[model samples]
Target: MRYAKWTILTLLALTVFGFFHYTLPQHDIVRIVNTYQERQDLDDWTRIFWASPDDQATGLINRDVQFIQAVDADGKPHVYRNEDTGWSWPPYFKFDTANLQTQAEDLKSTAEAPKWVSVTHYGWRIVYLSTFPNAISVRPVEGPDATIIPWVNIVILTFLAVILFMLRRMWLQFRERMIDPMVEDAEEAWDSVDARADQAAAKARGLWGRFRAWLDTWKGRPRR
Candidate 1:
């Protein structure tokens, strides 16, 4: 039973880690290679990974998604799907998909003269699933070795920790104020019942003793 509980807890922790790792914004320093628009078929499960265009109908099964192609400092290719995340999960509130694509195009550079840019994005590029991270913003950087502090993630995680702590304290207070009193009342009631039972037993013994004494008085007397 203990092993099962630990295993379940480990799995839950991993799930939560994976969820935040995929949904939270991350930065990648890369050179913009190109930008393009392509029609994407969203009739399958992979649709969940893509964001619907800001002006498109939610029920539409197909739409054109803009993409930014880039190469990292290590020459590894990275693709980002550009879309508006207005009023959606992650709450980026970005409505400048077209503008971002244009900026990416303007910043396009060749391998000989690489203009490194930091691409802020969320999600993952899964080759097997044919899904790309949605780019939230892009800005030019001094070099490929530019450092980012990930302040957003730090603040978000801290806020969540505070919330969890508050909830735990609230639960403890509830148990102390509400549940503890009920348990104490139950214990007191049981103690009262035990006392009554003991009193009744004492009274019964007294009555039995008196009757025995009365009978003993006639023991040596004549039958007449």
Candidate 2:
């Protein structure tokens, strides 16, 4: 039982970690090699990995998705799919798909004179599943080794921590103000019932004593 409990907890932790890792935005410092658009078939399970830019276009099975190809400072190639999140789950509110693609094209450069840029995106590059991270934004940096602080992640985590703390405090206040008082009232009612029962028993004993004394007078002639 103990092992099972630990295993369940571990699985839950991993699931949460994977959820955030896939959904949260991350930074990759790379030089843009190229940008292009291709028609992708989205009629299978992989459809979940792609974006639905329009509500009216849900019936369509295929769409042209723009892609950004780049190589990192270490010369490792990375590809990002540029698609608008459009009022979707990650809530990036990014509606500048075309504009981002144009910017990526402008930043494209060869290895001889590399133009280092930071790609801020979310999702994962699962080779087996053919999944690519959705690029949220792009900006040019000083160089490939330039450091970028994840301010968005820091702010989001801090806000979540504050919300959890506030909720805990509210629960404690509810117990102190409402639940505790109700419990005390129930205890007091039970004590009152017990006191009433004791009084009833004492009154019954007193009546029995008076009856016994009255009966003693009837036995007086026999005693003489």
Candidate 3:
């Protein structure tokens, strides 16, 4: 029993240590990839309306548009009074918010995803820079796209629970098998010992009562 308990404790410690060691790096990579993908999606939508067709027709450019605020001559911070909309730099194509979601997903599907290493500094950074003139494609990873994290968690948890449950059950079965005969033998031995002890206790109590009675009678005797 002691050995089994120690084995279980050791196994638990090993499992915890192994999890941190093996899974942490993979989880980090997945997180970085997901962040890049979401940002790319948002950027792509912005670009569709504003950027001119270029060598990279993905529709990203860095430009600012001036809007006519109160043209009277006051010019009191026209930026605030002016409605902040997409810059008036000549648009390449018609912008449609209704089709933005579809365009975003299409960009995700068609765009060659940069390698994980280059995603943050190169592609993702460029997307951020392009936000001035054009919207980067907004491919917000629709419905469990390109990720297995949740499914992997479920599978691993279920497998571990089953294995541990079976291990515990098997241990219990083995223990019951090993201890049943010993328990039966102890019960028989206890019965015999209990009978003898009960008889001995009765006799001792009777002898004690008799001795008290004799002392009381002697004390009651008259002097003459």
Ranking by TM-score, best first? 1, 2, 3
Off by over 4 Å in 3: 1-145, 149-160, 184-195, 221-224
lDDT tens per residue, model 1, 1-224: 99999999999999999999998899999999999999989888888898864667878888889999999989899999999988777788889988999999999999999899999999999998999999998999999999988999999999999999999999999999999999999999999999999999999999999999999999989987
Candidates' C-alpha lDDT: 0.93, 0.92, 0.39
Candidate 2 yields a Cα-based lDDT of 0.92
Q: In candidate 1, where is summed lDDT lowest over 10 consecutive residues?
A: 51-60
Candidate 1 Cα errors over 4 Å, as ranges? 183-224
lDDT of 3 by residue, 48-149 (tens): 433343323333334333211111112121110011223333322324333433443233321134222100000111333343222222323323224435
**Candidates 1 and 3 compared by lDDT, better number:** 1
Q: Report the error of model 1 at residue 185, Å.
A: 5.1
For each candidate, what TM-score against the reference? 0.79, 0.75, 0.34
**Candidate 1 vs candidate 2: which has greater lDDT?**
1
**In TM-score terms, which candidate is top?**
1
Tell me the lDDT of candidate 1: 0.93
